[model samples]
Target chain A: MIELTVNGATHRVDVDPATPLLYVLRNELALNGAKFGCGMGQCGACTVLVDDRPVFSCLYPVSSTAGRRVRTVEGFGTPEKPGPLQQAFIDRQAVQCGYCIAGMIVRAQALLERVAHPTEQQIREHMNPNLCRCGTHMRILDAIRAVAATGELHRAGEKGPAS
Target chain B: MRWRRTGYVAGAVLLAGVIVFAAIAWQPAIPPVKSPDIAITPELVSKGRTVVALGDCAVCHSPEGHPAFSGGLGLRTPFGVIYTTNITPDVETGIGAWSLDAFMRAMRHGVSRDGHLLYPAFPYIHYTKVTDDDLRAAYAYLMTQPAVHAPAPRNDLPLPLRFRPALAVWNLLYLRPGAAPALDASPRERGRYLVEGLGHCSSCHTALGIIGGESGRYLGGGDVDGWHAPALDVLAHAPRPWTVEQLSAYLTTGLASEHGASAGPMRPVTDNLGDVPPEDVHAIATYLMTIQTSQPPTAPKAGAVADASQLARGHALFDGVCATCHGDGGPMETQLGRPPLAASSALQGPTPRNAIMMVLQGIPWPSHPKPTAYMPAFADNLTDDQIADLVVYLRSTTSQPPWPDVRDEVRRARKDLSHD
Candidate 1:
């Protein structure tokens, strides 16, 4: 049995400790956002955040993720209220059929969390695992930029001071 | 003085440990080295762009309004519908994180980063035929594009079917992941790969069992996008067996000698093929011609009937059910824009699969620009044995060379088209 927090909710599940965290999330917890693609972890279709670091969930076993916070696409906000990256996908019309979107969002969230402002090369270097066959790559960059700009706007509007 | 010196030594040791810890913890995570600057010179870019166009990567990769190279297209096949994924450079969402080696494996080896076999439907089988240099150039061009973060849609195939390891079994039967067959025959045979593989001419040109395996009457057109794909081999009818020059012209411009213009699915092929270097097109033409000529399918034996009464009954059934469109004296030219049955080389081919498929499925009505011809499916009306009797009757009555091997073809076609 392992305890994990996903999307702000805690869950305890009994299963093979060596099962990929992706399977635990999708099959055990019924979180379909994280997918299983090329189970060997080649395709980044099964990416998620473990302790705020992006990892291919297909390769990361549930045992290693015990007591860790796992962030998935569902955690990135819903259709009614989307997170910055989720909104970015929509604004750029980035989700075609959308099987890769969740993984893309999960991976992107890790990058944005660490590097508030990433250059094109930085973004490319960080997220090369996700493969899109539809060829909407340019728009994905624009979507990320849009999200960054929105983040900046929010930061400027915030009231802040160190006590 | 001794006590003060001891304190200093301990402090120095603590400082040294702190420095070592910092060195290990804050190591700069430099990205791996990519293929040394592919001289994206205008000439190189142009070469890469042409290859991109030839491969029609956009047809499978690009979705409407999506950034180019960011994938979202949906391809439906007999097995199931598979959605395209995002191929952008998004650090989190796209392949911006992949090494060049990973990309190469996916393309050439049909293996992904984690080492799962990709389905053949991805056409890596054909792509594997692409040269490393060309693949690199194409990759370079894609790398230059903006990264989209859109995810691919879930493949709705059944459970074990969706399992990646199952592909290991599929690979044994069909996946030969490598370059196209090396042509040792004439230049024409060499071009067959370009036409059949990357050109994907066989995707439409070849008759397939409804489930997507090769049909007996190879290159006798099948159905795509609701249009009938016309037969390409000499064994099938199109008024004339396309000569090398004619096929080359048809492939390049969708025009050929006095018979028909390519439209519908052929439009994209011609539009793309039109831009193909003339030399490549010629090579493809040479290859396509050589394959059929080498095979030289013999016609079924002529003028022999085991039972005269049975032949008469078969002939009577042909006149009633089939002769209106395919009869010897029927006005074949106006109804089907088709060649006369007596004159069809397809009739002389070893098997009557082509004729049977056409008769059963109906010819794609060709419209100029794009064909909107609708051929109604006939399985609801015809039985397996009845279709077989018709096959025997047609070969005996019309085909110059009797089609003796038709029984197996009928069996195969029936099996393939069972769902239809």
Candidate 2:
């Protein structure tokens, strides 16, 4: 059994040590925020924050994240009470097929945490590993920029701002 | 009066030394000739193409996004950056006016048409062994190419090296200008001629001294642009020993089932070799097999467990970043037939330099042939600490002992990346 602290909750999962974190997250825990797009790390649909760093949870082993903090899109907020970044995404309409949005949000959250105001170039470079086939990159960029301009993401983590 | 007489004697000795040096260093300029009116046959031109490919002339002479043989590539050396000269037959800047004899002299003696001493970076030491027939064919092919008027940038050498005559002394010590000895007409002999002469494999494969002269350890391991060119004589030491067929396949296609794909500097060489005839590559493989120095087989010892905290971080990084491509169940191994990381020579080697470089630089898309194996560079994505962790994790999986200084290796690789 591997103990994982995910989204402010602790769960002891009884599975093989080699099982991917994505499998455990969706199967045992039923937190389906992280989608499984490409089993390989090429596509970032399985992105999650391990110790505040974005990693491909699909390829990441659950055994390795034993003591680290794992945050998924669901950790940000629920559908009715979305986080600042999520609200910005909703306000900017940064959704197409929506398969890639969860990963995009999780990856962008990591960047926003590190850099309060990322330039367009920095955001583009940071988001390069994630592939969005729906052509909603401009909207996604706008959403991140909107949140950056408001500076609400910085305050959201310390004190949850009402949506 | 006694001190003045001693000064006069010292001055006289210095003057005599200067005169002797000048006598040995001076070379007369060859007269320029018009583009030869000789009718070159298509057969000769075709053969010349093969010869030029074998020589890998364009690899040094041409910079990327430039016309072939229109030289401007800067070769970084221990001395300094030496720019390659334009070999295209442009009358103004290149060898358009060079007569066959002038070209021959440059190839065999490291002297330019204007009597200037060419640097040994041009590999004339090895070219001196090339036969006259091959030289003529190469000259014919180069002259037929559309000339580009590009002059080379000045070399970035120190003050003493800036003096061209100094190379004359260096040549006297290192250069041996003559054709290689005649051998029986066999595939092995043909391979030897190609490898030793025009192929110039030793230029990179052989170790170098402080002055950049070959250290006489022919086909022994050497470094090229921070990547280790593994010793050619120790094929038997590989996890899956290389056979003639495997080497031939690797030479032409840049991929072997048992061994990893070629990356870094060897990629371009294999890309060039892909265009050559199969027989030439096969012969090279055939010849290389004969030169193998057998070693006592080492028992695969189990690696000792590493620090738990560091191992955990490394395992996490590997799972998140490296395992997608390198894992046993990874698509690269299952579908593309890439060997496991344990089989990689870079991991099994003495140092962590190549492994660090492989992660930092990865393999860029090939230009000549279609891309077979491509890995995105982690230099920008992963920090030095992360890379060190990944490398340590990889070494732990191997049968060999852990590398002593992985973090230092990563730092060195970062330095090389900055230079690039």
Candidate 3:
């Protein structure tokens, strides 16, 4: 049994230790935010936070995050009380198809926590690992910038009463 | 002993090559076929013009920004570029010296007046099937063009190219010079002949082989230059399935009431098609409608949230920016000439790419004087988010499937179009 602390909820997932963290989160815990796109580490659709650092869940083994704090889009915020970053995304209308947004928000959050004020270039470089095939890179960048300007980068994840 | 065996093998190969070369290079005795002696009447010239248009003569032969039929277009081939020859009746430099029999032989057998092998780039394989009556009329029309002094550009291909004997071998393998099978002399058969033969639609629409002959996939759609020539065979997938009437309108006037105005390489083809009789276009369309291309259905809407507010946002955005031009009885669509959005294939189609592209790129004036409609690019002015909302809203109004990840598409489309 693998113990996964996703969005502050402890769950014991009975799967292959080698199973992609994406499958465990989605199938075992019912977290549908991270997607299964290009199952290789190449696409960031399967991204989630491992101890507040962005990692591709598609490649990250379930066993690796046994003790690490894991967070999926569910922990980010609900639609009713969406975190500031999610609200910024709503304000910018950054989500399309929304298959890639969960990963994008998580990665952007990681960058904002470290840099606090990321230039357009820094944002682009930081988010380079994630790809939105539909070409929403510009809007995603704008959403991140909006979130940064409001200084709500850290607080967006604080709500929802500790998952 | 091994070296001796090798020498014998080499000598046998050399002997075979020599025999092949001799056979291919042998000149046939020219039969005295008289040129049509009757004076060219106005009727003959007009009929000949139709034949020329049917063949799309101006597109390949007439070099861009050059005089018509003076032929300096450089057609790319796998081996190298083959420059189109001057077809204008310049006595010294063009087909003026070619007798009627010689011209027919070239059209039928890929042979020149001098008994040299002509390249398949001339499309004689398809031209071989063109009726003699049409051929004669086409010639009568060409003979009327003013003989320009300009000579064709020299073909800058690798050595051992365009040599009479060598090309004959290439022809022997690839060229099946004969008339295409006609089940009956119906209008559909006539359309098939025109589409497959002198019109040589398949030459561009079908993929080419390594030897540079038509792969004969037959309307499977091939690329001409950079733009894609859509498939016409069972693989054809228009946003809205093409009906005979819509195809006829598109072929005759380059505009269909349903969707998509001709662009890129298709512009010249549609323009040329306008010169032909409407009945001819109708016949072509009749034959084309029989082709059934099955494409995979759109992605399921399982993951879609379908929130009412999300749709409302899109509807609001469309009303603000697009309603002025695309609204019901909007000035641009109703009065000016833009196609109606409700009947637009791009909006209702399985994919949002075309509609989104049209919105982002907009319609530009084609080189031809026809259509005269214009839709300016919104890539610079509209925010990606707004375009995403607009595309979704427009699609919803038309009852199209909700496209996922549209903001990314808008962003990428803007980048791609900016480069263009």
Question: Which one is best on lDDT?
Answer: 2
Candidate that beats the other on TM-score, 1 or 2, i.e. the better one: 2
Restricting to chain A, the TM-score for each candidate equals: 0.88, 0.92, 0.91
lDDT per residue (tens digit) for residues B315-365 in model 2: 777766677677778777786666787777778776788898888778865
Q: For model 3, how does the per-residue alpha-carbon lDDT over B316-363 read when each residue is reduced to its tens digit?
A: 655544564566776646753446775565565544556667665566
What tens-digit string does per-residue lDDT give for candidate 1 at B318-393? 5444554445655443543544555443343444665566445543333223522233233322445556666676
Candidate 3 structure quality by residue, lDDT tens digits, A1-163: 8887988889987876546678898898888989988664456888888877677777555656756788887887998999777888899899788888989998888777666576776777668668898888889888899887766565454331110
Predictions' DockQ, in order: 0.01, 0.13, 0.01
Report how far off residue A143 is in candidate 2 (Å).
21
The C-alpha lDDT values of all candidates are 0.62, 0.81, 0.72
DockQ metric, candidate 3 = 0.01
Per-residue lDDT of B391 in model 3: 76
Worst 10 residues of 1 chain B by lDDT: B371-380
Q: Give the TM-score of candidate 2.
A: 0.73
What is the CA-based DockQ of model 1? 0.01
User: Alpha-carbon interface RMSD of model 1?
Assistant: 27.5
Ranking by lDDT: 2, 3, 1
Off by over 4 Å in 1: A1-163, B1-39, B63-70, B86-95, B145-149, B180-193, B200-238, B294-420
